[model samples]
Target: MPSRSLTDPPRIAFAGTPEFAARALEALIGFDCDIPLVLTQPDRPAGRGMKLTPSPVKACALAHGLTVDQPDTLKTPELRAPLVEAAPDLLVVVAYGMLLPRAVLDIPRLGCINIHASLLPRWRGAAPIQRAIEAGDARTGITLMQMDIGLDTGPMLAEHVVDITDIDTTATLHDRLAEAGARLLIDTLPDLLAGRVTPRAQPDHGACYAAKIGKTEAALDFRRSASELGRRLRAFDPFPGGLMSVDGTPIKLWRAEVLAEPGAPGLISRVDDQGVVIGCGAGSLCITELQKAGGRRLPVAEFLRGHALAAGQQAQLPG
Candidate 1:
């Protein structure tokens, strides 16, 4: 909705939270886009100190001297005033966390564009990075789409596909996708602003919600196949993690590999330098990295030095 010609640079407003969003903002700044204001969620208590922490987006905005706004909700007219006054031509929203009401969406002339972690219509909600890996998806990518009222249901503008390796964890995949999204947005901005890009409706099929991840789902279930368990172990790393209880001592699994051999479920078939091999329903898993409740993740050899886990021991699994 900028008054200037379509080829001219339009005033872009940005909204986002977290490190993922911060990366995109950094890209926009690097591109020398005319960003007048940044919108992010309010500061929240974080870390063991429970001190108020600025969202990554806000921190980046302040560092770059960009005007920042934090509102509890944009549903009210008063809360949406700053955005209205900014009069941005287009709003680029990443993982802003808060939903934009209809009023806020209509403020910009060209509406808003979102940078999503997964290819739209696939993982369409929070925690897409973890869900894709947990679901054993072979490939995942970033989707830049127009924003609508529905959850990630808007038409897609473009996408950058990223191959999912067998060993990728949510933490690892998240970094890759975050950078990819930044690059994709930069590459597509000119065409999008110039009206050279067309929005294509997402397919009706292949739709699924990526529900937010919770700590409760971190426990490792030996009843599942080794491959499934292995994927989960990698997916949950640096988060709730793959939990297992041995001799009543809870441990978090960081890295693992599936094996063809089988033994009684929850049974430990081997424990040596390779890993702590544990049996599952279909096969076995070699757990290479582990952490204690309050300790750091360490290689199996280092973990063994502090804990006494023998091959005959059984890993406690949920009944």
Candidate 2:
């Protein structure tokens, strides 16, 4: 392949879907590259009204007046035709939601590069951001990798670590990682286009998969240790949301902290204006914020004013 001049920006075809992906697209737009086409998922019903909503990448592409394609699947010959004809220098994919086949992968001269959320070889599937927090990892970060057929088994081009804080939720962590991923992608693009960055194979050992988060997984089990449950609550927040049942009434827990106290699992050992302290199998957690079914999330004092939960009440995972 002939090397393009350093002054020339590489032609790029971007594939992405969500806000995380959109952020990368946004970063690329600010770069000197030419994004001729953007491939995203088809519009789907979303939110309370169930209105047809475009993927964040599609919206961003449209706003920038770039051509966009929302193919249900990229495996079709017809869909792959445009990509082949475009003959892009590189294919940049981030959170595109669908796997790319070999036919599509071969279209780009420079090949495909992906911006994945977690450090390569760890938390390497659908829900990396949430999985890292749930597992209580002290740090997680973005990995720019050369795309291959395997699931995030691609060789690493660049990586940057971001620390996970005590109060960080999935939502907050996601945003921070999105920006980090964006910046990292832009920084790496120059070296990648210039052929200065070399791909490194990810280590086979100590690798783990981050399976997608399920709504059912959000059901809080107080029978577990308070520290574990507290992390789970933060990890699942602003997504499926952490759920629990207190005295047979359904509730969603938004924020909690381990209290270093012990009592019978599922028992409400104390309740005051500060919060509701619930006993776990090993320790206790002070639920600082919660919401009743069909109600907005409220502080412990506000929630207590409307629906009283006194000491001796039990909190458990919903059946």
Candidate 3:
């Protein structure tokens, strides 16, 4: 590797789409890294109007005055040709949504580096942040790995861990990990450019795939223990929140805590200012916040004002 002065920054091509991806781009740009081009997912229909909306990464790239590309697919020769022409020294990929073929991966001189949301060899697929909390993992973190053809089976260059708390939600953890990943990437860039960073292969043991969260998974199953239900409620809080049916209307569980006692699952165990205490298979859950179909999130007291949830009544949740 040729040694260049700090003033001569490496030409980097950043590929990503979501807010998490934007954070890394922001860090790279903050350090004035040679971001010659930014590639993100194509704009798609969003919101009630279904108007095409640019991804967070695209918006950030444009804001930074960086050249942007919204390629629908990189497998095409036309799309991959321009990226190769750019002659980027390194490619940085975050949540870009589309898989990169080997042809595209081999374009950059230093190959591609990805800021994955989880520690490699564990939670290697999509939805790692949510899955970690849903499974009640003790800790989760970020891994800067070399991109490969395999599903996040890349060699890791760096990693940082963050402990998961009982009250932590997916939103909170995602933000923290994104910031951590950005700092780690920026700190490691100098070494990466100097060819001092060595990639380490991940172990096959303790590997788990975090399948993307589906709408059906949002349906709360009260038959599960309170602790398990509580984790789901927290894991899915902001998106596809743990849901139940009340008079056939889908009710979202926004906030909840587990209780120690046993009762009939889905039974209304208690009701208080905080919220309603619903029984699970082995324990109970005190729902502090909730929302009904076509309704806004509200505190338990506020929700009770508009709806009736009496003690002893059953709350049926989908399995």
For model 3, the local distance difference test gives 0.89
If both were scored by lDDT, which would come out higher, candidate 1 or candidate 3?
Answer: 1
* Residue 162 shift from truth in candidate 1, angstroms: 0.7
State how far residue 210 of model 2 sits from its true place (Å): 0.2
lDDT of 3 by residue, 77-175 (tens): 898866877778899999999889999999999999999988878998989999999999999999999999988999999999989987999999999
- Per-model TM against the reference: 0.96, 0.96, 0.96
The sequence of per-residue lDDT tens digits that candidate 1 reaches over residues 283-308 is 99999999897898999999999986
Which stretches of candidate 2 lie above 4 Å from their native place? 1-8
**Every model's Cα RMSD, please?**
2.0, 2.1, 2.3
Clash-forming residue pairs, model 2: none
The lDDT for every candidate, in the order shown, is 0.91, 0.91, 0.89
lDDT of 2 by residue, 148-255 (tens): 999999899999999999889999999999999999999999889889999999998868999999989988878899999989989998878888887688898899
Q: Candidate 1, which segments miss by more than 4 Å at Cα?
A: 1-8
